[model samples]
Target: MLRTYFPLSFISTLILLISTCAYAEDHTDELHSATTQVTGFGTLGIAHSTTSQADIVRDLSQRSGVGASGRTSLALDSNFGLQLDQRINENTDAAIQLLARKADKDFVPELTWLYAAYTPNDRLKLRLGRVGFDAYMLADSRQVAYSYTWVRPPVDFFGSLIVSYFDGADAVLSFQDAQQGNYQVKLYAGFARGKSYTGHADYDFSLDGSRILGGHLAYQRGAWSARLGYSQLLVKNEYSSLVPVLDAFHTAPLATLIPDAAQLSAELGMQNKRIRYLSAGLVYDAGPLQVQAMFSQTSTNSLNFPDSYAAFLSASYRMGKWTPYATLSASRPVSAQIPLQPPANAPAELVQLYKDLNDGIHSQRNRQSTLSLGLRYDLSDASNLKLQIDRIHSREKFLVRKEAPDWNGQTMLLSASYNFVF
Candidate 1:
């Protein structure tokens, strides 16, 4: 299926490009007289991973390391983007970018961004169509080899779920001065509805959702730049199969080691469910050294589970040809309490069992921390190499089984990429 879809998608893109180019050619004189220009950029990479346990790292941009062989593989982290600019007048112009890449389960190129912008002046600009959310300038561009020092951004900080991009419309405003330098403020609001695949069987489900609003602000002067951003996601759960099981465990009786028929009857209950997240961060750069930190917290009011919060800090230094960096990240659940409610049909024994389990499980929350270090060497203007090592630790008082081993392992990655702009 992928093989068949790949060619068709490519052909369609080719046709669109030809049509756009032909249209531009028709107005060649006008375009040439205006500030019309076209440019392209891309990156290619390969990496390896070694883990003590069986784990698969699958995400939107790359999907390798699926088997339990604990081996390495080559990855084409390549992307091609086109920038078209046509000046309408001295003070106003039109601009748009079309980006394509191999993502998730599909190898065929898809439209990553297709937005038209109107920059009437230096202070303000309006954009509509597919837009990129400036979650974090560095984080957003982590997949680009030339954008950062690490072979990959810190997973502890970046995480698997939080780093994904969204498609929407955005507006940007700028302020600048000869002495003070420049600052950019961006406001992004969009709706994204798609399915994300995780390794877990029960967790994979449709992501038909919408985001009401979000934005970021950035300032750059001399050798330093700083940014701050905040965004919220309102997610609806489409998976209903797991609800019964979740509710069963959450409301089962707690008095007996094992619940009897009567107790089980008293425990069954129904409740509402919803998931929400809040994300924010800041970054700074000075000369060859840079520092960044970010924080994110998520909560589900309907679920009895506690809120989750994560934090990350990183610093990097440059030395002639090699630049080295280090990062630390940690996450833990927040505190929240609510009275246990059970369905009318639930048995008393079942309700007691659930209460016991909930009390035991709620006593301790999930906590994870990771430390990473890496170095990048600039091979040339169009190429670079990077090597990174990460040590990760996860602990959960309630979730850890007596027989199951705790999660403490190291992952080493070596990647090199060649990028070109034409």
Candidate 2:
């Protein structure tokens, strides 16, 4: 078996930190007022995609998530997650999180997080293991639906990348100023390996020893907070299955439209693809109203997957136990094109096929310019009920060349979820 894994450095560092933190915490507890506590949080959500030809998933990483297409036989938007935290002492803690989610008709349980965190001083804290590098405002709290207004985070923004964690270390800095607001920043590096959906099927890829470096900066004052973040993860992707797609381009009528198919393959799939992401957002939470807006972009050198951008504005008004919210989101691919100049004698159908291939480039995107309105009622402090409806458009296509493409459509979706924390 060709079993690939992260270098043991990430794992070994984790063991050392866990042992150090636990011992330090336990030793301090005997003489001081330090204590340990356990905590948990999660959500139960369901969504209905109204278009029979389209499946509306919460994020691109979800394999079997919800949609109206034939997938109606399944409810894809639902998921459950649990987290455990053990405080070794006032300055140290160990944590683990487990999530069970549906992917392509199967429910799989996986460990989402495992780490030990230590605060050496009031301003500095360090963490080691599998930890999320914040790409957005609520990036770390995304799985907790009750913390947000919508049925789900705007997919247009959050769905831009599937890989959230890297096996490594992070240093967090927080500064407090009497004259100014609070400032916080996080810096991290590690290797990220995972199976991500490429061309509709899951493809496995590793960091190839390239380090992942990223961080976020934030300022908070009273009821307002603003944040900006950027990250770069260079992936030398190996697309073994895509070899056939690149091979077929060399023969027959298709060759005319794509003369340098091999070059295109190298540009899109072969190696040295640096995936860079940028995001900025602001939030205002005061009185009975909560308002926020976010803008995000993913840049890379992949012809098949061009650079993408998204942004959204959301507002919610809280009325006792009832909260109503509205959101406007947009997503699109930039410089998404397939060069083509068919000979005049070429059959009309062949030319159309060429055009379809160009269209298919952006069709890989699942969300665009959506509007959502929803209401929420607190079932209790630990749980709440949400009912939401999204007006969405679909331009999805099959990734494999063999299957015929799906026509575009639009629909209104209904969603309901119950979120909890204990």
Local error of candidate 1 at residue 277 (angstroms) = 5.2
Query: Candidate 2, which segments miss by more than 4 Å at Cα?
Result: 1-36, 68-75, 198-211, 247-262, 336-360, 365-367, 395-406
Candidate 1 per-residue lDDT over residues 193-241, each given as its tens digit: 4554322222344544545367777778876666667665554443344
Which candidate should be chosen as best, given lDDT against the real structure? 2
What are the lDDT figures for the candidates, one per model?
0.54, 0.67
Cα lDDT of candidate 2 equals 0.67
Q: What would the TM-scores of all predictions be?
A: 0.69, 0.80
TM-score: which candidate is best?
2
What is the RMSD of candidate 2? 7.8
Q: Which stretches of candidate 1 lie over 4 Å from their true place?
A: 1-38, 56-70, 76-103, 160-167, 176-181, 197-202, 240-282, 300-306, 335-367, 396-422
Model 1, position 36, has a per-residue lDDT of 87
